[model samples]
Target: APAPPAKKPEIKAREGFEVDGQESDDLPPVFTTVPTKEKIVFLTIDDGAEKDPAFLRMMSELKIPYTVFLTDEEIKDDYGYFKKMQARGVTLNNHTLSHPYLPALSYEEQKHEICGMQDVMEKRYGKRPVLFRPPFGNYDRDTLRAAKSCGIEYAPIWSEEVFVDHWEYREWDQDLHPGDIVLTHFRGTDDWDG
Candidate 1:
């Protein structure tokens, strides 16, 4: 056997957030932190505008784990790129079909945006994601309802966003917590070159 593929390190789940069979009946568990004392943070990248091979190679070599929230419009052009990332153990989640502001849309419209993407994702990726992140970190009660109806179990917004040069914090203290979620994006050199 070819060295029996190396086993990846298992991620320790934060307290109060069981990794298996943890379900909620109210609002799909909106959270910004994982509620743990461990000095580990979750990485989430939103949008799929850039499909750089170099980025994939770097991430694969480093063996970093992250989730990607993909908008259909941006990623529909080159989903195979994402499939390659998926092969490397990245989880693909839903952003939306058009990246609309969910709060501005009606309940039906919100359902269409979310459920539509769910269908597309299932067809393309062979799995329906149970996690969703609303666009621009904006959503309302209806958005949560729509996500629930579409079978999403969690909705997580970032506590901070990491840019090429600096970190943007949502808290006044401007410090990172133990289980804080960090957000980034798929951008080419043009978007971050400045």
Candidate 2:
């Protein structure tokens, strides 16, 4: 019999980035980047429109660690696709039920969009997500409030966005910094220009 792989060390949240009991009502800390000097960046993919097998194979082969923020409206089409991703040790977080522009929605509507997805995730994925990303990176206070009510503890916007052809950065310098959160969508050649 072959030797089993060694267990990986746990990654802890940075100081002041802790979630539980850190805020009143547990409203999630919103940030575009994690404050760290380590040579590490976070890769997050949004939505669930594409189910490219090659992408999954590449990530798995590369041993890349990434997170997925899924919208029920898109992922409900193929829940098993993400299940395979989960089996790869990926954590699926909440985007929303329908990926609506949350600021325009009333409080109740926003809660429905957020909390409803939390329910769907718990039912289908076996865990309620603690992280959320608002659609289009647009949100308001009500969005955070609703998300907190749904048990979300962190809401992150991207410091950089990755498209097929080029990358977009939030900073004036077109470069990546330590602790930067890079965002990408579940898009392929048909959806973006290469």
TM per candidate = 0.86, 0.86
Model 2, 88-131: lDDT tens digits are 98999999999999989999999999999999999998999999
lDDT of 1 by residue, 1-194 (tens): 02222553333323453323333436665577766566778899998999998888998788777889999999999989999999888899999999998889999999999999999999999999998999998877778788989888788878899998999997899999987999999987889974
Tell me the lDDT of model 1 at 2. Answer: 21
Best by lDDT: 2
* Candidate 2 global TM-score: 0.86
Question: Candidate 1, which ten residues in sequence have the lowest lDDT sum?
Answer: 1-10
Clashes of each: 0, 0
Residue 100 lDDT in candidate 2: 90
Off by over 4 Å in 2: 1-26
